[model samples]
Target chain A: MHIIIVGCGRVGAQLAQILSSEGHNVVIVDKNQESFKRLGADFNGITITGVGFDPDILKRAGIERADALAAVTNGDNSNIMVSQIAKRIYNVPRVLTRIYDPLRADIYKKFGLNTIGTTTLVAHIFRSALLKESAKHEFTIGNDIGLVEYRVEEEETAAKESGGGKK
Target chain B: MYVLIVGGGKVGYSLARRLADEGFDASLVEKEERMAKRIAEDLEQVLVIAGDGCDPGRLEDAGIARAQVVAAVTGDDEDNLIICQLARDTFGVPRVIARVNNPSNEITFKKLGIDTVSSTTIISKLIEEEATIGDIFTLLALKRGKLSIVELIIGPKAPAADKMIKELRLPADSILATIVRESHIIFAKGETVLKPGDSIIALATTDSEMALREALLGKE
Candidate 1:
């Protein structure tokens, strides 16, 4: 699948490398050319140096034919604008954005755009790890339901599988 | 009316001060705490909120919920767009205006149904109008840059100076709308005779602006 990733930051570079290695066509855009270095010499992908929200830059990145777009720019507003342009203008099938502000992320989600608030998610993860909690909240679905992962010991799993779980 | 102005840059600062002076309730939100404090001290009538305008919480604190109009004049186009969207879509503000830092982003802003003012576009237009020869000035742009209403002065040595309107070879998609001679306005007609010093207001396709000017004032 043809994918366009805005911002060649750590996450964007990693995503690009993984997708390109998986044989998917990946094009990453960053305002600074220096950001492309994060992708490393072995990474195989196209790099565009321009603002992600710019239509001309997006067109040059082949947004019209992109199967998916990820806007992981450091600026939340820039990411939101790029995701909106990819989804509403180019009609890219899949679009995702990373917004650091949780409130803004929730508000943008109401606009029908997929957003991940790294600040909130990271905080949640840190809290769970620091507390050594068995259950970790991965993400919240809509306003209420939270999808959580519960860690179980190997013995507990084996016992449960044998229908001998502790009461 | 209560108006919320985002970004404490020069444009936003001056606009908020002017609006407050005009007896309107104006509130400004600036990301830079120092600048916001300076503006708060400078503008007695304007209320200043120090926070990121893109943040809905900051906007709400600046009275976005009751704002009749929201103007996002940030230097960053993306931030302005986000603030406008938050004001219009979330707060349901009746009017939202954004300042597009990059002139090319004007169309995108317009496409998203957001009113945009591009200083770059306006400044470039002024420079273009000033640099234009033959005393032709673009009065207004219409049809999304497709057409322009221009005011051209018929110079003493112009080709169409003393010619009849019907005999003048105007550029395609161009028509003389009216002529102001000696403070008298005359609606252009086929039989009307052109005269030197007459300021002709014509409607022409933007692409034909130069041709129209050359047709009236001759090649310069």
Candidate 2:
């Protein structure tokens, strides 16, 4: 899939690197030139420096042919605006935006936007891990389906996921 | 009527003050604390909230759901567009008015169902009006300037004064419509005598304007 990821923050950078490694065409756009440093030296993808929502800049970033777009900019308004432009103006099929504010994220969803709220997602993960006994899955699709343990007090969730060999 | 205005710039501030003066329940949301405080101090009757107007929480706090009309008059076009969209589509505000800073964005705002007031277009029109202001005010210039209705404020030195319409040699295709005096409007006829300080309304074609101006004011 050809993807245009706006913002070169941690999530954007990691997503670009992984998607590019998987042989998908990835283009990362950021207003700051220093953000490209997060992608490392060997990663091959286009980098654009301009406001993400600018129609001309987006066109230059291959928005016309892009299959997906992810707006992960720190500003919620910027992310929402860019996502709306991609979806409504350019008719991009797949559009996603990361909104940090939970309430604003819900509003975006109500407005028919696809929003990923890392704050709420991480907060849920922490609450579920701390409760331990409250996360009762009502149904399981397959025997391999397992909810990996996340340590709320420790940084062991990443290690725990790899250590579990359910697959 | 309840009105919620986004952005506390000069436009929003004056609008809020005027609406409050008219006894409307008006509220203004300003992103800057200092501006919000200053506007709050100046507008005794309007509700002022200090926060980003684009934020849904702040808008809700400012009573967006109950607002009969929402005006997004921020200097920024993008911010204005989003605020109006959110107010209309999300909250179902009955009326939404957006101030479009860029004339090019007016069409986009209209297509999105938000009514826009483009100051750029209005300012351009004002500049056009200033350049054309004279004794002969071309009210309606039509069809590539072929036909027009021009009004002239006749002064005491005007040579057309005390002259009957039929006696004066008005150019062909030009006709007098009305003589607007200080107190009344006189529908001009062939025998009507033009007087000093008479505001003359004439309908003429493009080529006849010079002749009409010369006949009324005596010269260029």
Identify the candidate with maximal DockQ.
1
Whole-model alpha-carbon lDDT for candidate 2: 0.82
Clash pairs (backbone) in predicted model 1: none
> What is candidate 2's CA lDDT for residue A139?
16
**What lDDT tens digits, residue by residue, belong to model 1 across residues B90-121?**
99999999999898898788888899998889
Q: Interface RMSD for each candidate model?
A: 0.7, 2.5
Q: Fraction of the real A/B interface contacts present in each candidate?
A: 0.76, 0.19
Identify the CAPRI category of the predicted complex in candidate 2.
incorrect
Error of 2 at A58 (Å): 1.9
lDDT of 1 by residue, A102-125 (tens): 998989988888787888877866
Q: Give residue B41's error in model 2 in angstroms.
A: 1.1
> How does residue A18 of candidate 2 score in lDDT?
95
For candidate 2, the per-residue lDDT at A128 reads: 60
Q: Considering just chain B, what TM-score does every model have? A: 0.92, 0.67
